[model samples]
Structures are given as C-alpha cells and as structure tokens.
Target: MGAVTRLFELAAGADRLGLAVTRIGLVVVLVWIGGLKVYHYEADGIAPFVANSPVMSFFYADPANYKAHMNPEGAVVPANRAWHEMNRTYPFALGLGSVIVLYGLLIALHPVLPQAATVGSFLVAVMSVVTLSFLVTTPECWVPDRGGPEHGFPLLSGAGRLVVKDAIMAGAALVTMADSAKAFLRRRARRTPAEVPSAGAVAA
Candidate 1:
C-alpha cells in the first residue's frame, strides 16, 4: 500500500482503540460527577440559571427550578443571573454533562449502532473543545499539590489532566473522521464505472 493509504488504514483501525479508551474515560467522569451530584444536591452558592433564563435553563439546570423561574413570581432580577446560576449549578452541570458523555460513549461502543464509534468520537470532540473554555474560565478546577501533611499516596490532582485527556480525544476524533471519509470515498469509487476511451481516441 502507498504510505498515505497505509496511514488511512491505521486511522480506520484506531476507531476500536479510541472508542475503548474514550468509553473508560466517560465512565470515570460519569461516576465521579454522579457522586458529586448525589453529595451536593443543594443549590447554595449556585447561580440559579434554571431560575432565570427561559431558554438556557433546560440544558443542565434543575427542571423544577427552570419551571419555577421561567414565569417569575414577582420582581425583576438583574441581568447577570445566568452567570450566578452557572456557578450555583456547577456541580449539577458537571453531573448532567458527565451522564450525557457516558451515554454517548456507550452508544459508540455498541456494535449494533452503525457508525457509533465515529459519532461518539465526534461528541467527545465537542466536549473536549468545551473543556478548553472551562479550563480557561476556572483554573482553580486544576487543584494541585498532593498528600499535604497526612496521606502519602501522592495521588495526581487538577483539572489540567482533562486538558491532556481531551486533546487526545480530539486527535482521535480527527483520525476517525479521516478514516470515515476515506472508507466512503473508496466505497463510492468501487460503485463507479471505469471510464473507457473511444476507439478513435485509443488509436491516436
């Protein structure tokens, strides 16, 4: 095979590995965030996004809160309420986002689902891109330093891990996209008829 063709084949083979890796990551994230939501259900210090914007509230905010605040009970609130809601609902947002991420990964892993892996990689790519914004906006999310004066495992810390993790996923997504495109092109080329020159043209 040509070098380029071999590269495309390698890319095509990456789907299985990428899906497996991404599935594990998604599971870890979901379990972690789900645990967080279970522990931190209260909305204290949260920004009340569900209670403010009508359109934006449905995504990750509590549906009840969204319904409650969508109509408003009395006075008009400030415009920055959305930001506040974002802060207050941060844990919930993470929890819900993790669930969706996990679901996408699961779907990707299912062989019955055609193009599941490619679709999952695309979804993960979107999450990775969004993680960039989250990292920029909340550097504190990358908690550093380990063990302190007590435990001695020196476990890894910080949201910075996510930076590396997501970047890898994005690269995998690119590979999957390339592989899919090549496969599609190859299939189309096979279906197409080979062109034949006219007798007069061949004689020339």
Candidate 2:
C-alpha cells in the first residue's frame, strides 16, 4: 500500500511538471516563429499560404502577382522588393510578430497575472486552428510530383510538414487554456463566500 501510494504521488508530481514544460515549449515555438516572420525570407516562404487563403488574401495588395515575385529557392529578387512594398508585407508581418510575442510573454506571466495568461492561451488556440487549416486550404501543402518521395494524400511537402505541426500547438494551447481557466476559477471561488460550503454540508 505504501509503495502504491508513493507511486501515485510521483505520477501526480510528474503531471504538474509536464504542464509547465508544455507551456515553455509552446512559448519557445511562438517566439521563434514569430521572430522569423519579421525577416524577408520567412515572410516570402509563407506567401503561398497567405495568398491562397480566402480569409487572409486581402492582406496582399496584389495577390494575383504573388507567384511572380516568390522564388521556390527562397532567393531574394527585384520582384520580391516590389511585391513586398506593394503588398504591405513588412507592416503586416511586424504586426503579427508583435501579437505572437505578446502571447508568449503573457503565458510566461501566468504566475503574476493569470487572467492575461488565460487570454493569451485562448488566442494561441484560435491561431493554431487557423494555421492547421492551411493543410486543407493551401495546395502547396501536399507533394506535387506523381512519383516523388512521400507524394500525394498522406504525404506532405516541406511547407506542408511545417504547417501540420500546428496540430500539436493547437493541442498544447487547449491544455494551457484549461489549466489557466481552472486556476482563474479557483481563485474566484476562493473570494466568493457563496461558494463556501456550510459546516453541516461538510459534516454530511
């Protein structure tokens, strides 16, 4: 019985630690990717996804001309400059990067301002779902070649593989949101006299 009790306690401890680690992992990913979006190469790489997205296509000034400027090799060209300037790419990227960074910072502030963290987690969840949708909406997600490596349905191109990883982020965001929400509720409950059980109820 003692050994069993000890083992259960250890498992509980590990579960608590796992939640912290998950939050940290998500923060790292959001901050890193968000930071990269500020760069021209990363912004160019994502042009296809944004250009094809019905929800986001308006962000580009010339969505029709996106292909003419984007190089599959990720090279910077004269066309790239014109496309970026005309499309307002830099300002858009900077805005997105700022939002992402704020989310990470808010998550890290969980101990001090849990309400903010809860909001951040919710935002992360929403963003993750949008990103994962790219797998279906973006044609570049799957391998184009007929006989190429991992071609077709179950297989993804390099860009597709990257987008697919958003599934994990979505899951993580949900977990973080649940945790933060529970904490917030608990704190609220503590402050509410109505939530406290009477002595008779406790005895019962």
Identify the candidate with maximal lDDT: 2
Give per-residue CA lDDT, model 1, range 132-157, as digits (tens): 44444432334544655532122223
Measured by C-alpha RMSD in angstroms, how accurate is candidate 2?
4.5
- The alpha-carbon lDDT assigned to residue 114 of candidate 1 equals 30
lDDT of 2 by residue, 88-204 (tens): 777778788888988988887777777888889889989989988888888889888777566777778888999988888888888988898888888888988776788999999
Error of 1 at 43 (Å): 12
lDDT of 2: 0.84
| Worst ten in a row by lDDT for model 1 | 38-47
Q: Any runs in candidate 1 off by more than 4 Å, and if so which?
A: 1-123, 144-157, 198-204
Q: Candidate 1 has which clashing residue pairs, if any?
A: 46-88, 47-84, 47-85, 47-88, 48-85, 49-85, 142-159
